[model samples]
Target: MGLFGNFVAGGLAGLAVDLCLFPLDTIKTRLQSEQGFFKAGGFSGIYKGIGSVLSGSIPSAAIFFIVYEGFKAYYSIYPPGSTSEAAVQAIASALGAIAACIVRVPVEVVKQRSQVSLDSTKSSLDVFRETVAKEGYHGLYRGFRITVIRDSLFSLLEFPIWEQMKTFYAVYYGLEKTAPLAGACLGGVAGAISGFLTTPIDVAKTQMMLADSDALATKMGLLQSLVRIGGQGGLPGLFRGAVPRVCWISIGGFIFLGVYDSALTYMSTVAV
Candidate 1:
């Protein structure tokens, strides 16, 4: 499929998956919050920041797929000498993640705060306004760098594994195309692995974004925040919310990749 096809497919897939699993995401965010899950509204208002996520998911996902597919196409033509297919996939995935983070970071900042908001009545708009008013426009992107790093790392692991698994399946079955069900299963496993492995980075990123303007976490770098988390809570602390995150992303990846493949297949046939 073409770049536009990728964009549309990815946007729709992201929207579907995000909306379907938003509650799990909220739970995961709260679990990773500095205030602890109970203090971060517990089970109440899991949909708090959905507006912000809804607004950003499509554009960010669209941008990612466009860049990712475009890069893969380019790499296929140019053929990076001696680089393994896994490495090439990793490079494309990281670049796509980096590009996506331009929109994803701000959305995450607002969405996380909203997820952990003390007041159930507080709207996402309120969080956005408060963040800007208190910390300027930059507040919306407080964890931009860390977010990019985390997502790039995640993509590096996830995309390559997912692709490799599909390749294996195709080769074994002698199939010309991978079914959506196979893609979903492989994507889920890859996402779970990546999500679990990256929990520490995600924890630090969450703390960084949720930190108050003058908070120590806000002032400290990613490494410092990670060290501090490890110091206070040990290994378990670093992996806090890992279960929910893995569950959320596993389900989300299944849906996202399945829908993307299905949509792209349909679009390709339609174009023909």
Candidate 2:
């Protein structure tokens, strides 16, 4: 593919993967955001509101990927069909991820609230309204900036690294052996890497949204939460949901890459 084409390819692939499994993200966030140490919702609770997630995520992925591709094209420093520009591609992916996260934060808030708000009777609209009324309009976008940073950083590091890793694996093991499991491993590693690296911020973001409702005498800032977590649980405390994150990411990574690679190849032909 040409530079433009690669840009298109990478973005569409990312979006495709993101949309297919966005429900898992909603699940993951709620799981990570639960109370108590290692607090995570069970299988059913995480999977709640899958329908609503799809209603928003699929198109959101499309927009993210397209915007990412456009950014790649804009930032291209190499000629078409050249492999030396892999770094540029990586940067483009980062930019795209940033854009995607910014666009998706509100959706993230809604989807997460919808998934975890199981009061047995509150509908999605009810939950959304309550969130807005209680938290205000800006409340729906609580973690907007943090989410953008996390999503951008994770994508910037993970996607490009995964691409390079995939190439190495393909060259080392040949195409047949570098199958679903390989992709899954790459994803798991990438997830753990990004998740681990960003856990401090992740915890802070959660605490902010979570504790926003609490009218405690002691209100702590983001850095204070980090320090508090460190003081209380040390390093392990920060990564409370690391175990589930690894597992979820591994599955998601494999599915995302596998699906994207196959779908992109098909899309290339179909787009022609």
Candidate 3:
């Protein structure tokens, strides 16, 4: 499929996933925030920042897939059976993640802050303007570096595993290309694995984003933040809301890959 088609597919996939699983994402954020697990409230509060996620996810996913598919084509010079194929996918996903962060950081900043707040009535625009007014435009990108780091690892694991698993299924099991369910399963597993592994970094990212301008003065770097969280509840503290994250991202990945691949396949047919 062409870049524009990829963009549309990615956006739609992301929008669907984020909207569907936003409550889990909110719970994940709350658990990862400074309030820690118990004080973060119950499952009922999970949809607090759904608006921010939906708004951000559409554009961010579009930009990511546009770059990701473009880079995938560029890196296709490496033959499929070659070891370099994995390396190429990893590199392309990393680059795509970094590119996606250009838009993701600000959205995340607003989203996290909104999620952690007690006020459910506040709109995403309210949070954005407050952040900008309180800490300047740069405030919208508070955890930009860590956001990139977290998402880079996420895509690095997710895309490569999805592709490799599809190859394994097709080559070994003779699965047909029409089996989008297989793709969804592979994508869910990849996302679950990546989400589980990256929870600690996600914890730190959430904390950093929720930190105020004044708090930024005493803000911890990644390692320090991890250590602090570890001190709170040992290894589990670092993981925080890993269970919900895995669940949310797993389902989201299923939808994302299933829809993205299905859309591309349909588009390819239309083009022909």
| Candidate with best TM-score | 1
lDDT leader: 1
- The runs of at least 3 residues in candidate 2 whose Cα sits more than 4 Å from the true structure, single-residue gaps closed, are 1-31, 37-44, 75-86, 170-188, 213-222
Question: lDDT at 5 for candidate 1?
Answer: 95
Query: Where in model 1 is the C-alpha error above 4 Å?
Result: 77-83
- C-alpha TM-scores of all predictions: 0.97, 0.75, 0.94
Q: Clashing residue pairs, candidate 2?
A: none
Clashes in predicted model 3: 0
What lDDT score belongs to each candidate, Candidate 1 first? 0.91, 0.61, 0.83
The reply for model 3, stretches above 4 Å from the true place, is 175-178, 216-218
Q: Poorest 10 consecutive residues of model 1 by lDDT?
A: 77-86
lDDT of 3 by residue, 158-250 (tens): 889888888878878765553777898899999999999999999888888887677841377778877887887799888888999999999
Cα error, candidate 1, residue 197 (Å): 0.3
* Tens-digit lDDT string for candidate 1 (97-187): 9999999999999999999988878899999999999999988889888899899999999998898888888878989868999999999
Residues forming the 10-long window of minimal summed lDDT in candidate 3: 36-45
Question: Which is better, 2 or 3, measured by lDDT?
Answer: 3
What is candidate 2's lDDT per residue for 7-51, written digit by digit as tens?
454445455545566555655566456454224344555455454
